[model samples]
Target: MSYDLLFTGGRVLDPGSGRDAVLDVAVSGGRIAAVAAGLPREAAREVVDVAGRLVTPGLVDLHTHVHPGATYWGIEPDPVAWCSGVTTWVDAGSAGAYALPALRRAIGGYQVRVPVLLNISAVGLTGRTGESRDLAHCDTDLAVATVAAHRDLVVGIKARIDAETVGPHGLEPLRRALAVARACELPLMVHIGAAPPTVGELLPLLRAGDVVTHCASGIALGRGGLDPALRRAYDAGVLFDLGHGSGGFAFDVLEAQLAAGMPPHTVSTDLHGRSLHGPVFDLPTTMAKLLAAGLTLAQVVAAATVAPARALALAAGTGTLAEGVPADLAVFAVEPGPFPVADVHGRRRTAPLRLRNEATYLAGRLLPPRLPAPPPPWIPLTAAQRTALAARDRRIRDLLTTPLVTPDDLADQFPRPPDR
Candidate 1:
């Protein structure tokens, strides 16, 4: 069959098939058709020679916030993720029952595949501290219905039950979220740290398919490192995610966790606009941090690609470079130097290595360069639309300015608002 593109002379590393060798890969119809030494380029349409770069399966970022208006925490998803060699990004609870439609609309027509985790809160993380604060917003029935409605895009359920975020109703909201997750037959991604319940209490509540994010965090009420309870959870097949967000990770905690043989199941940069420049720069930087923490090259790559896809239950070959798999690949350079990597705290550690993305390909197409463009002309709002928008804006403003009311009081005030 005629091919679309050929990538030649690169060191191919595919953990799925346990193959590592210098090979030429051929892409036909946007899928990998062959990987062998000295494959003839004569049958190909275009050839990209990457002699010295490391060619691996396209990276998968398991944790991110991609929803545009639903969550203002991060940069736009496609450019930030794809330019950095990430092809598939699992949006970590940026939308919930109410905002899923808008999130889908924002991302549906894009090339980059984004699987979203439905937040337990109906509104998702549209707030400064996140969306799990008001226990009344954690609607199990609505969350379950939303997941069922968008079964193709919604992969799992997410709940941030941190102390500062969840306030007093810590475990109660989590219990309700789990109930929703169970009803939908999907895994639950729990953001643990600085919470009311002890790690001991939290671990028992999770099952095999559940996920524990911020596993090495020092910010949680249980600032204690990865304890025996967490290990028990891991042993029981509960996945651990390295959600290295702006304020959740701690190098000390990570070191202790790694030392205790509790390696993270997936390595993800909880990247956002504020955290993009440092501490959690990007997916490659997060992987480099894991390497600096003593994981081997293969181990780090596996966590970033295969393991994350497995956790999300993406198609079998989606994150690997095996023949017949989609031709999504990343070319990277591993530079040797004393690279200073920091944790959530101001502490830093210098390691003798760093991985940087040299090039990225989605399917068989190279990503187009980002260009600056003029802003669009403002359109005049219709009288009816303007009035409705004004009313909605006022309601949101009032909700923000209102004093901290009980969940029951909030429920009474906003009784079963329609899903957005």
Candidate 2:
């Protein structure tokens, strides 16, 4: 049988099957037909020679906010997905029951695959602090109903257990969220930040499949390096996700965690409007950070592809490039140079190399990055849309007005850890 397309002379890496070799992969009718070292280029309608690049299963980002024109922090998924080698991205609590209709309407006709983690609060990340400030919004019944109604879209639940988001109520909202996750029999992606309940307190509640996002934030809430509770949770099968947002990732924290034998199970860029320009650029960047820290390139690729797929409980073939699977793949160029990497806290590190997405293929269709053009207007500008956009713009303006943080500002804003 003739193939539709063929990728030739590239190092093929499939973390799921531990298959790493220089091979030619063939695709037919949107599924991978064969993977071998030599397949006649004449057999395919198109043959792309990718000699110096690496070919792997399309990257799957387990955390992101892509409810474009809907959520305050949302960015369009396709552009980010295509430009960064991410074929699948999970919307990490950009919408809840009350706002999910708009998210569903906005994401229609997109080329990429986006699974969603329904927010526990009725009104998701609408405001700056996020959705759980008002205890009344943590309605398990409403979340359960929404999950049941949109079972195909809703894969899990998200609850931000941050000091400002949860406030005085502390772990009550989390309890409600846990109840909702249990009721739906879906996993929970809990965003842990500055604590009123603390990371230690939160770990006891998470079971095997539940995910702890932003585990590398260097906030002063959880006491000591690598909290014992977190270690115990890791041992108990709780998954750790690198939710590298504007304030989530810290190299110091990541190093400590890695030394503790708890490297992130899934690498995800908590990609949102505020972080798109800076430290948390994309999923590929996050994976590169891990590679620089210690993980082999293969291990980092596994975290981005198979590990995330398993965390989300996707079907068997979802994150593999084995024959008969969907032909979703990413081609990347590993450039050697002094690539500077930064964490959220202005801490810097230099990675000897960086991974750049050369091209992405979703079901055998190649997608390239859009050339620089004027920013497009957000579509379907309803009242809700305008409110969120205006708020975001105001924050952006404030960020611009605040002169670039000088040495004094950095010293004042991010205090050094007290002398032990």
Candidate 3:
């Protein structure tokens, strides 16, 4: 049988099936047709040699904000997603009921896979403190209705259940989000940082199939250094995701968790306007950091691929390179290096190995890499750009503080489809 494309001579490492060997992969239409050594070259219309490179299933980032032009925290996904070889990106609660219709409209145009986690709040993250800050916004019924309305786009519910996002409401927002998730019959992904309810308070409320993101953010969960609370949650089947945002990942906290025999169930980049710049450039960078922190390449690949695919409850063929699956895959050249890796706190570590994305195939087709965006404009400026604009410029302040976008901003972008 003739194949649409062929990838030959690559180290195919698919942790999902314990596939780690040099193999040739053939694609027919958009699904993988075969995976073995030495397929006849004449059988494929196009063949690419990938000797010495690592071939992985298309990556899935469980946390990101790609509602660009619609939310203040948003960014264009194609440029970043293509550059990083990520085929799927989950926008973690960037838009709620009022804004979801527009967010969905924006996502439909992108070629990438964007499964969203509906925000439990009515207004979502487009507010000063966040949607959960005011309990009035945590309309469980509204969120339930919204999820029901957009069941195709929304896979789960997201709630930033920290002191900063939800304020003194503590665990109240989490509980409400849980209710909405239950009502919608979807999983709940909770973002935990410094918390008033504490990690202890959050875990027991979460049942199996729920997720706790930012597991290594040096929050109350990591203060005591990887204890029973985390272990119990893991035992309860609560997935831990690395929501490595601008401030969510801390090496010390992660090391402690690792020492206690715990690692992230899935890896994700909380990519947005702020994090896409530095410290959290992309998912590979996040995965490389963990590789530097002692996770084997296989472990890192599993977290980024198969594990996240399962966590999101994606369709049957979502995260594997097995035959009959979508031919979504990535190629990376693992470079030996003393690469400088930094966490959110500006602390740095030198990694002995780094994974560099060389090329990617999206559903049996290769795409040209778009030029990467320059480092955040403010990063390279002089003292004047720093001090002169420090007090007056809204853009500078927004970049530095990384505040949540206001509801008015989203309303302007996705204006509620004129009443009937």
Candidate 4:
């Protein structure tokens, strides 16, 4: 049977299906038709020769903010996704009950698959922080109902259990989030940061399958050996996620956790407005950071793909290149170098390899290149960053204005009608 597209000459490394070799993946009708050593190129309508790149299932980032107009954290996902190789972008609580409809409207415009974690607070991230300060905003009943109605889009529940987010209301917000998650039969993803309700206080409350994002936060969990509280929670089957945001990831904290034999279950970039410009640029960079911290390429790939998909119990074959799965895939050149990677605390480490996305595909279609929008006004940037952005804009303008081909270089298809 003829195939829609054939991707050849790439090292296929889909950790989910234990596929790691040079394989040709064929796509037909937006699903994976075959993955084998040799797929006859003549049988395919289109062929993409990814000679020296790594081919894997599209990276599934479990934490992001894509609701552009509805929240301070939101960023447009398509532009970033096209270049970053992230196909399944899970917006980590950019919307609560009130703003979910707006988030849904925005999702309709994105080219990537967008799953969301509904915020426990009714007023979800409208402001920078303090969303759950007013205990009344943590409306469990409304949140549960919202999840039930939008189960197709929402995969889990999110709660920011921090001193700034919850104010005088200690762990009440998390408890309410748990209530909603329990009611909706969804996984609960809790963001950890500087705490009034300490890690020790909240770790016990989490059930198996609950996720602790920013698990390496220096501000919340500290920089020493793994705390017994964390150990207990981990042993009890609580998933630890590397939610590497602007203030969440610390190199030392991650290293210590790795030393303690507790590797992250899922690696995600909490890619929101503030963290988008620096620190947490995309999922690939975050994966590189994990590499610097101690995980292998396969380990991080599994964390970014299969592990996160499994954590949220995503669709049957959401993160694999197996036959019959959707043809959402990423191609990357794994450049080897002593790349200096840094954490939120300005600590640094040398990454042995970095992934540069060469092409991204979704549903057997190549994702077009999309330029990122300028940072929002409220997003603070250094003077150097501002100048760099200005230069980039000028470069794009220059490229667009310049002529592609001169009269002699162009083909005269109509033959000018004999100078009529």
Candidate 5:
């Protein structure tokens, strides 16, 4: 059978399949047809030459907030996905039982796949914080029923356990979230921040396959070192995710984890409205932070792809380029770098390599590039960032305002009558 599209001469680095070689990837019927060393160019309808580019499964960002215009943290993933090569954008707890339907409706409008980690709080981040301050919002029965109703969309459960979010409730909110996760038999992804219920109390409650996002949080980790309890959780198979939101990741804390031989199981941008512009720009930038932290390129790729897919037990072939999988693919230019990358605090690190997206495709259809909307009024920005944004707006205005061509460049259609 003839293939629909072929990507020739790319370094097909599919960590899920353990295949990393200069090869060709063919797609047909919106599914991967083959991944072989060579294929007849004549058999495919269109062949894209991707020489010297790195090709892999479209990235799966395990933690993000994509229910825009509804949740305060939400940002539209499409504008970011096309340019970043992230096809699976997991909306981590932007909606809870009360708000799940709205989140579900929001995702339908997107081109890329968006699986949700249903928020434990019924309010679901509609505001900036306090999603779980009231235990009533953390109703296990409601959350379980919501999961049962939308198993197709809900991948896991999410709870942000922190001082501001939980208030005086402490670990009660988390206990309720765990109850929902247990009832559904789905993994739980908990976001950790400041105290009332510290990581010490929080880590022991989580079971295997459950994710602890913001694993390197300085505020949560206290003294900025690997606590024994955190180590125990890691040993007991609790997965760590670098949920690099506005205040989540800290360089020193991550460095300590690395020193202790504990690496994050997955790297994610937690790319909400607050973190979208600065600190956490996209998944690739977040991945580069791990590169700066000393994880090998292959290791980072696995954490971003197969590990997260397995962490959530996502659909079959979700992170693999195996034949019959939906042809979700990405192509990137491996830019060598002494590139400067920063963490939430003003700390900096130089990365050795950076992957920049050239193209992203989902179900064998190329994602169109889309410009991002201006930052919302409440999103905090540095003065320089504000100035840069204004300058960019001016540039776009200037380009569009200018005439397309001079009068002399145009040809007359009715030259015989000297058309006006």
Candidate 6:
């Protein structure tokens, strides 16, 4: 069959393909139709010869905040994540039952695909500290209904059991989230850095398919330094996700865990508005940090792509370059220099290898550069524009002042509509 596009001559590094040699990949109708040695250029209508670059399955960031306008921390349009070689992004608990429709609308028509983890809290991360502080917001029934409604987009459930967030009600919210996850047969993605219960107490609650993000972080409930609780959790088949956010990664703790044979099951950047600027710039930077933390290049790539997709139970070949898989790919270059990688704490490590994005493709289509927003005109604002701006400001203020869902309102919101 004739192909739509062909990529040739890059060092193919798909672990699933089991062929790291130079090969040509042909795409037909957005799927990878062929993978073979030296496919003729005449076989395709469009061809791009990528030589001397590392070509792998597109990077998948499993933890991020892309809920625009709903929360102060959400990142809009995800800042060209695909341009940084990320093709799939999973917004981790940014929008819960009440806010998901708006989040989906904001991301409509984007090239990159965004899956989400439904938060147990009905309001999701709508407030500055998240809704965890208010136990009333942890609505298991509402979370289940929301996930059931958006099964295609909601891959799992997220619960942040941090100390400052959950306080004394940590386990209650977590238990409610787990119930929803069990009912839906979906995995639970728990954020464990600080907490009311110890990591030991938390590990037992997690089952085989459950995931624990911020695995090696040195914060309160984290493993600290190769704690036995983490090893036990790993042995129990609980997946550990390297959610390297601004305050969730600890270099020393990561080193100790790796040394103690607790390797991460997946690598992801918990990219949000505050963390995206530096330290944890993007997925590529997170991979670089893992490389510096002693993971092999192959291991790092697998954690970012195949492993995450598997954890989320996406298509088997979704994160691989299997013959019939989609044509999503990322081309990168490993720069050799004194690359400085930092941790959540004010610690830094200078490593020699760093992954840098060269180009990104989604279903064989190169992503376009982001257009800059036009500057405001110097002339006095028109009356209509002023009125519109004022209306918008008022709407934002109203949204902020609106009372959030309480745990007591869970039953009303789920399996039944709220009272008018």
The most accurate candidate by lDDT is 5
> For every model shown, what is its TM-score relative to the native structure?
0.85, 0.87, 0.87, 0.98, 0.96, 0.86
Write one digit per residue (lDDT tens) for candidate 2, span 1-420.
Answer: 799999999999898977899999999999999999999999999999998899999999899988755566787778677778898878999999999888877767677888899999989987667478788899888899999999988889999998889888889989999999999999999998886788889889999999999888887323244888889999999999989988888888899889888898989999887677566868888887887788888899999899999998876577789899889999999898577788888788877678898999999998765421112353233465457657767887798798897777665667889999
Which stretches of candidate 1 lie above 4 Å from their native place?
221-224, 371-420
Sorted by lDDT (best first), the order is 5, 4, 2, 3, 6, 1
Q: Which ten residues in a row have the lowest lDDT in candidate 5?
A: 411-420
Error of 1 at 51 (Å): 0.9
Candidate 3's residue-wise lDDT over 7-114, tens digit each?
A: 999999998777999999999999999999999899999998999998999898999988765565677788776667798899999898889999998898877888
**Candidate 4, position 284, lDDT:** 92
Candidate 5 has a TM-score of 0.96
Query: What local lDDT does model 3 show for residue 325?
Result: 87
lDDT of 6 by residue, 1-420 (tens): 789988888888887567688888889988888888888899899988878778889888888888755775677543456558888888899887889888878768567888889888888888756477777788777888888788888889998877766876757878888999999999999998665666777878999989999887788434456667888889999999988876788888888888778888999888876666545768887888888887888888899888899898875577788887878888887688678888878688876687777888888888776632221233134476557657766886797788777677766445666599
Candidate with more favorable, higher TM-score: 3 or 6: 3
Clashing pairs in 6: 136-406, 136-407
- State model 5's lDDT: 0.92
Of models 1 and 2, which has the larger lDDT? 2
- Those runs of model 2 whose alpha carbons end farther than 4 Å from true positions after fitting are 220-224, 371-420
Identify the leading candidate in terms of TM-score.
4
Q: lDDT per residue, candidate 4, 1-420, as tens digits?
A: 899999999999999999999999999999999999888999999999988999989999998888877788889999899998999999899899998988898899899999889999988988899999998889888898888889898999999999999999899899889988888889999999887899999999999999999999999888783779999999999999989988998999889989889999999999999888887888899999888887899999999999999999888788898899999999999999789999998899999999999889999888998999899899999898889889989999999899987889988677655565
Over 228-285, each residue of candidate 5 has an lDDT whose tens digit, in order, gives 9989999999999999999999999999998998999999989999999888999999
Write down the lDDT that model 2 would get. 0.85
